[model samples]
Target: MIRSEQKSPFRVYRGATIDRDEIEKLRAGTLVGSNAFFSSSFCEEVAEMFIGTDPLAAVSPCQSPVDRRQFVMFKIDVDLNQTADLIIADVSEQSNFPAEKEILFGLGTTFIIKEITYDIHRNLWYIEMVVSSEMFELKQEYTDFVHGCLKYTDADTLFGTFLSGRSSDYPAGISHLQRHLRKMKFNDPNRANVYFYLACAYRSMGKYEHAIEYFHRAKLLQKGLSSQSSYAYADTLSELAATYSLLNNTAKALSLLKQAVTLFRRILGANHIDMPLYYTRLAYVYWQEKQYEDAHSLLLTALSIFKEDMTSVFAGLSFTKHTMGLVKHALGQREEAISLLKETLEIRRQSYGDDHPDVAQVYYSLALIYADTDDKRIAFQYAQTALNIYQAKLPKHHPSLKRASELVERISSYQRESTLPQSEFHNVQE
Candidate 1:
């Protein structure tokens, strides 16, 4: 029996039901909590938070019922989508879990691991350990490790060095790419694409000035060049707009977004499939400007585009709807905001499954809405849900995690005060 000294980490797996094959896979890994498996609500929460850093962690084997004189610490590696593929080997000594484990990929879905293989000849592990979406929620040590890895691989890590390096040597890992880009010619349109990536990396690192510089460079490189693809111009303008927005220059952001919108409309047409992305950006800027009406109008347009376009872009469209919830709340459309947020939460859960960061976002937003409405009971539930996700998936010091913790504390106080027998203002219902 795997006896846990502490409460085990729990997850809620998504799907109609768990099958025997999946159960066997989970049992091999010493899965702790089955009751917390992902549900519709969990998926919604995960979808909401998918835009930012993944808030996910592994279920610790320490909570398993297996008793052992020697414990094995298996280090698992995950990719950009938060899917962990572990290569487990029996370690001679006990090792504390690494501080970082989750890897956030950028615009890619594959995890191609090379080298460091078992005997350097194994193709892959024979045993398939596919963790259900519901079981991916994590906290504490697991969260810290994942978040740390994310920070290490953040876009800025290389972008910063590239921009800072005046010499030809530049950064270590990306020098090959840089050399390849330079050899292809500086004026090549591909250079602009590289510049955009560099700009994004800078932006991720909060180097707004540098990001804006790279964005301008990308635009210049793209000048007098025409491509069959509209992504180049659209993405360049969007990056410029985002950089300005980050710098708190809302007017510039608005202008840049307008340019992007016009270009997208001209290239892809007004009702093109990608129109939703432009509209979403436009709405985001409007949101930053506190122009609720404009933002709402843009989001509605984007939503209409989504309804018309039946591509995979639907997932992105669903995300935009969730953003609209935040906008509505900002606009003081409390009822509408609450309703929209709830719907968005449901959609995320159904799509992504439970235990995804997007679902946690729903709980986070719901907690805020409930707190604003003074529904302490409901607020407490939402806050607890958010807190659980944050603790499991993000570092303890993360702003969102900290806020959730505070809300939990506040809710607990309220509960304790209201539950006091014969006390004045004891109105909290069990």
Candidate 2:
């Protein structure tokens, strides 16, 4: 924590780092935020990336020598015209190394990547960003929504919201929410909302059993809730259903999803913006149960609504397409399925960048589809890309990494035998 009186700003500090692939995930069009404090510096080495570009670099964490090409430089350009919510400090006069100008930014600031350019001559990559208030506003809006459902709008609420939503720190989010949960009285109106969010955070971290426990707890609190919103209850059911499906409890999953869809349709209307989500989820369950006809019909309904409002549902449309693609594959519409899945791939790359586990998931799905067809070469390519991403983004022992690696090797073995491989892979469940 710094002086509260000091104006708030953001700067990317040196020594703060991610791996090469993780670093590359901050593509030029991406919007990213730091959950920790960062500092920036201006030195001759940093400016050498591009002649016109000002130097920005960081010192080494240890006294060891640093590699030039692999080094990262951060520069923050805050636009005064956009909003006056942030401040920037040159801090050149106060620097320990007076020759190198330094800049400092506040903790938890967001930035929009402007450009990332590589200089061949100097063997360096230069990344420049502009400070943006949009992410902060979005996070705040979500926090406000959470507060409206409960009572507190204090520091813990803000921190927990940031961890749970924007930063995706599920463990920290779980800790904060759980601490908050202990403070709520048994019959408090806010208890249900806290339990609901806690369930979501646990689910995100793949603690399915823990998620189920919280969902059940939240369901019990529903009787005590004073809020008239059926939204939380419906969402809890829908999410719980998905988790159940992942756990292979298809019967329970189907029942819960049906109940969720009924309540969602009644409350938000069949054509509401969020209806497509419920429709698609239910369709996925049907597809998993091998009820292809039912799945197709639900997907078509969701697709029609998805077209009416594509703006707000940008990411949701991709999901609808992806689920339908799986259904189409099951229905033997391979051509259409591949096209739909490819669209999903592109949209996810734009939204989540190239290295996200979700993007790797799409790659794996496409590989499975191609593996079923005569196109073994295309299958190999997709499988290999998925393997590479999974290796980089997932833990060493993650099930996804194991599965992706196996898929790649299996495809290779099929090609080596010069025969059409039997399509024994499971259907796309995500």
Candidate 3:
């Protein structure tokens, strides 16, 4: 814990004595040995890979290591960031001495940043490692661990695929992730983070209930986990709330969101970058409940914060504008609503491209605006565009496609009726 704290402004310890052998073992690439003890939190990313009904087991235990008896040697990978100095320290503090006994044991290699360098031309980071011969006795498992780490590092690429609107590539990476997560022991604090990301990936794929399960596991794993960060707890709370919202349990979502909001306010005060997100979420829930006044008030506040920060996150911007448009349209402020919608569409198109789901959503919103305004011609065009985009890119029978098709058909019918001749209308009337 001291080592983890050493890297942060909130650190409570400095110049504390560390076990000499543990330090040497950590420096020597001999992590995951039998005697390790983690003072920091586990990696949630690893845990999220296995949150649903375990294909092999019946009841899932909240505070236990997963049962991986049926699988072959498992691989584990962790992405190392310089800011994760605390994670490195915690892993070192928990490791075993030459003859120590502990609940969690690791027998894997380590790669420090000094011996690794990124090759710009090759677009790869290379490392120089020397494994201890004594540790080589567990060579096969160690090799699997190295393989697991390599595979886990590809999460960034997988996340990129998701952002680029290629969510299908995510599940393909799941098998590797599942195998890696299963191999991890109960004491691996790093696994907590692994679970969190895995939950995010699940949520991205619209596996809401599945995501909620993993999110709970991540929260459980966070207990007694050490960190240099007070921000970690608040981040988890916010994530869980968002997941609950996705599950359509807005009451729980609101409760959790408020808790997270208070935590963030405590830690970062009222004007933090994350503060607006919480407000935005609260506004959305209000909007869902048809509390237009409350929703509008909160959205205006969130938008002001966002504007002042001037931070760039296209998805967030698009969502805020789209929601504001909805609230305005509901309030019968069509001109304001149309302006916001146009801005949202332009921003999303520039950032995500015309074919992106978010871009399609903007068009869908515009179609609704046009539909309500009795401009069936423009409404039908936008609806058709949205439907075509969804049908070509998304899976068959996707809800977005269905909704878009419905809108198109509604407008088409309206258009046909409006264009009928007066003589024909009179004859039908007679």
Candidate 4:
């Protein structure tokens, strides 16, 4: 227990050595003040003397495993001053170790002390003498430990690997980080970020259901952290809406997308660089609903935003152009559609190389246009090219590969029928 002396200018309180279990009990809020060893008479005397006195005026010496001994002071508030029943003194100055002097250091800090009682089971002495700075230091150390693991194995490298389209490596990297975070008891806000990134990784791998699950988990966690704001939460909602759209849950997708748009507008403003991307995403959803006029208007706005930023060669620029081409084709502006599609295809090929899935998609679009124009030979060539790329890059039963394969067969059948005898050709065509 700490002993106190009443001096003229300041009151000195000396504290007892605390055990590990006692410290844990204090942190857990299981330690009660009534059980402290200090006498009621001693508590009342100290409380009366320090009633209006600043907590900084009283000093205590505390023992630390790292520094051996340190002097810590507290900024006592009205609650603490009124509740104080005993005085603790500085014990570190008596030791041969150097005195680490700090005065009025812990001002503005808050501490909670339970009501003092005479229960023998509770150690009130430790409660009265515990300095807030010591607890603060311990918490800071724990936060450092959790963050140190992230620095040791950089997340940026893993994110870069994911961005490079190495889907096989991406999940493993994020999963490893997630496991570490869970094991370390990371708090809600940081954990939510991890879940959000995991959802994005799953989306990139075409696992829309898994992406939706993680995105929902992230959203719930984000909501729990009411004091914190996360920009990534908005992005997660937008991506989740896209996954819903892929699953043909159009109603849910539109609702979530609208929420995402509102959040992005609130957090980043409408003039931010990311605004055009969000607009483009909404436009694509409208396109899927076959609302060509609405989609076209959104695309025009996105294009204007991109042009204002002078980012015409950006990847989003190509994506917006590609969607616009599809919109034009659906509107029966075949000539304009072909020109836009060709421009998008060239941009994609230059940005992602010829073997990329995006390039293959463009090839499929070109094949469709040529087939509609009655250029069967050119259509067949483009379809074959698209099919080869899809078969190499995608799963055998992927929808894209199936579509490309079907187009190739249809074009081949047409070519064969056109070459037969006139009567035979008519019969085969029919």
Candidate 5:
């Protein structure tokens, strides 16, 4: 039996030999040759899992000398009653191997144990392994020996890290990971998902053109997939609509948002958590089109949904309130609009910190409201605050920066006119 009293520092194939040159290469952290029997994809998958890590410790019922230079081997087995683990594999059955052997050799396949565990219910052993060519060579050097022993970080883990950064409102981190993923060509199976995330990251960074490009890419990919992806396709459509709205393409934005709303209603039912978001998005399109009554009605429905499921939907309530405040202002409910806008601003500030673009948006909105009410001093202050945040946090050419600059300039002009002498003011009025 291949047993170690002390935990094995590294795993190796029993009876396999490595020459001095191969040993030196192994120390250098580079795999020298491909396994002729396995496909390139399979080899790449295995390399991703085991290349930069110490060999996994496993107990194998085979006796062999301790050869530090030997390549690590993983074993594969199949059992009818055992549940499959979540490890990535391209497993296939081979019947020629002995059922009870710890090491199995067949016509063109070798199975070395990767992991073994007992099934409590069925009283059977479950084994996970890799099937590879007999002559496969893995070369590593001194650097490989040190850094290659670290635990593998899979693509899913890296994706989750990017997502976590995005959810925490760190656009720069999301941009960095998006670039890395693109460079790695890492989204083979889930190109839509990767593209969607990249779109969202670009949107958050105020790169609307790039955001629109990626959103369209994601939408196209999602459309090409089977019906199982309908929900995702709909969500992508909704996101694309939002990007269009930001670019002031109101007609296309409204059309896409309506399509998205229909799909969401069909797939998720009326009361699903996504319902409020769809309603709010549709409301935004209406607000953009100056359909105040329609926008107000949709915002009310969205607010009702949010109130019913406050816990699960609390994160979106502030956004709904912000939109509703604008609608209320358009409807001439000035006091109610101010109250809602103030509450939304406070919530955003607490949730995202003072310097976030979302907070800047709220500042700009308040400036508009106060300016309409002839509160020029307060309007100028809020506009200047919004301008500072946009200049600091957004690109120079971003629409939000341009709008804030215009608002600040207009407010400054008004302040200058208001401060003119009575005779000069009368002359200008005349």
Candidate 6:
């Protein structure tokens, strides 16, 4: 009966149905529950339990399934480091089937989905995840942001504010924001902040009209906020522009992005950590306009700023890489674009885990790029995976969701065509 406490950190395996996209994105800095299990023995888990950092901690082993279709085989790489007390035990000797090394976790234990991929040949999904220590740090970071936002607010409201923006819990986020707003008078100092976040929540959920209305309201109420502050009204302008960009209103997006960039640069100066964010946003809009040169220039500026101190602005750094990757592709730099995108993908996985809309966006871009080349054979797989993540989180009519769905259908048709006889293919084309 080997235990994690008596040994170094290891891995466990299991077969699971991905029922929810929101994994371990904490509710009020507390863990949501799961029935996931693990083991060190092959084929199935032993009954022993142990503790480690990764919720994906290993203490069990199992043999591969004979029927791939019947059981989804997963190769989950779990990273368990020093953080919290999550148990993983190997009880192979104690089990009736000793070959099946089983493991267990503490109740209410949580985890994050870092990355996911499909193996066509093995019929397996590779979920590359590093967790626990990272999870605790991430949660603490978000909780600190909540403290900074609402100094006197209740813990529930603090957690609610986190949901809409960071956790991708739009339903819970909106409910909390609406309730919080009702308690505030029209002239309350925090009213603008509430309006700003409410707009953010609505935008995240594809409620563009409501988002726009609230953004305008926030803007009107934000007159007293210092223009010099990095988190002032300028941020609202940038967000409003993003919502417009999603609706194909590039003109509005471009104008607002320019305004936000100017404010960030002139007032806040180039020293602010978020300076690159607006520049990248502008570059994204520029790409849509086919102003490739302008976009490239802005991306260069953004990337340089990001390289100064990468650790502090990890998310911004990844976004810069992601944007630059797309721009590189548009410039016909396919190899460089793919490389940058792959780097961005790993960085985002390490930073956000799986199930984030940002992660899905990366998958979406990679699929589009691959679908256009000789790698079109696997393009459908990438597209389908992206569509799954998008479906779990994004709204039905959201542009990203709509585009991913269309891409999946288009790629699926291509895949089906490849399976047809030459004569049949011609018939279908006709």
Score every model by TM-score.
0.49, 0.63, 0.55, 0.55, 0.58, 0.66
lDDT per residue as tens, model 2, 1-430: 1224334443433423334666656789678887775566645443333233333433332222233225445666654546456555567687776655665666877788888865454344567888788876777776776766344334554567567654556668889988987886786666766777777777655577888998888777563343354676788788789889877788999999999999888878999988988898898888888998999999899989877877546568888899888888888898998999999999888766787667777899899999987888999999999999877755566566777888888889988887654765453444
lDDT per residue, candidate 6, 116-192, as tens digits?
55444443334543325444565678778767656634555566668875687888898998998888777776777
Candidate 4 residue-wise lDDT, 294-365, digit = tens = 989988988887877863335678778888887888798988988988998888776677887777777888
lDDT of each: 0.54, 0.72, 0.56, 0.59, 0.60, 0.66
The parts of candidate 1 lying over 4 Å away from their true place are: 1-189, 205-207, 229-231, 343-364, 376-430
**What lDDT score goes with residue 37 in model 4?**
30
Name the regions of candidate 3 deviating beyond 4 angstroms: 1-186, 223-233, 417-430
Model 1, 1-430: lDDT tens digits are 1112113322211112222344234334333332332211113233223222123532222222222211121122222134332122222123242221222222212222121211112111112223333333334344665565344233333343344322212233244445555566554545665666666655544456767887888787665555543557676887688677656688998898898889888787898877887787778777777788988998988888888877556456656776788788787787887888788777776665655445766787777777665587898898898788656655445455666777677667767775412111100000
Local accuracy of candidate 3 as per-residue lDDT tens digits, 27-132: 3243333243322123322222233223354322222222222111112223332223223334434555312211121333332322433233322222333212
lDDT of candidate 3? 0.56
Each candidate: RMSD to true structure? Answer: 17.8, 8.0, 22.1, 24.2, 19.9, 10.6
Q: Per the 3 Å backbone cut-off, how many clashing residue pairs does candidate 5 have? A: 18
Worst ten in a row by lDDT for model 6:
421-430
> Which lDDT value does model 3 have at 44?
27
Q: Which stretches of candidate 5 lie over 4 Å from their true place?
A: 1-171, 183-187, 224-228, 419-430
Query: What's the residue-level lDDT of 86 in candidate 4?
Result: 29
- Clashing residue pair totals per candidate (backbone < 3 A): 39, 3, 37, 9, 18, 29
User: Model 3 shows how many backbone clashes?
Assistant: 37
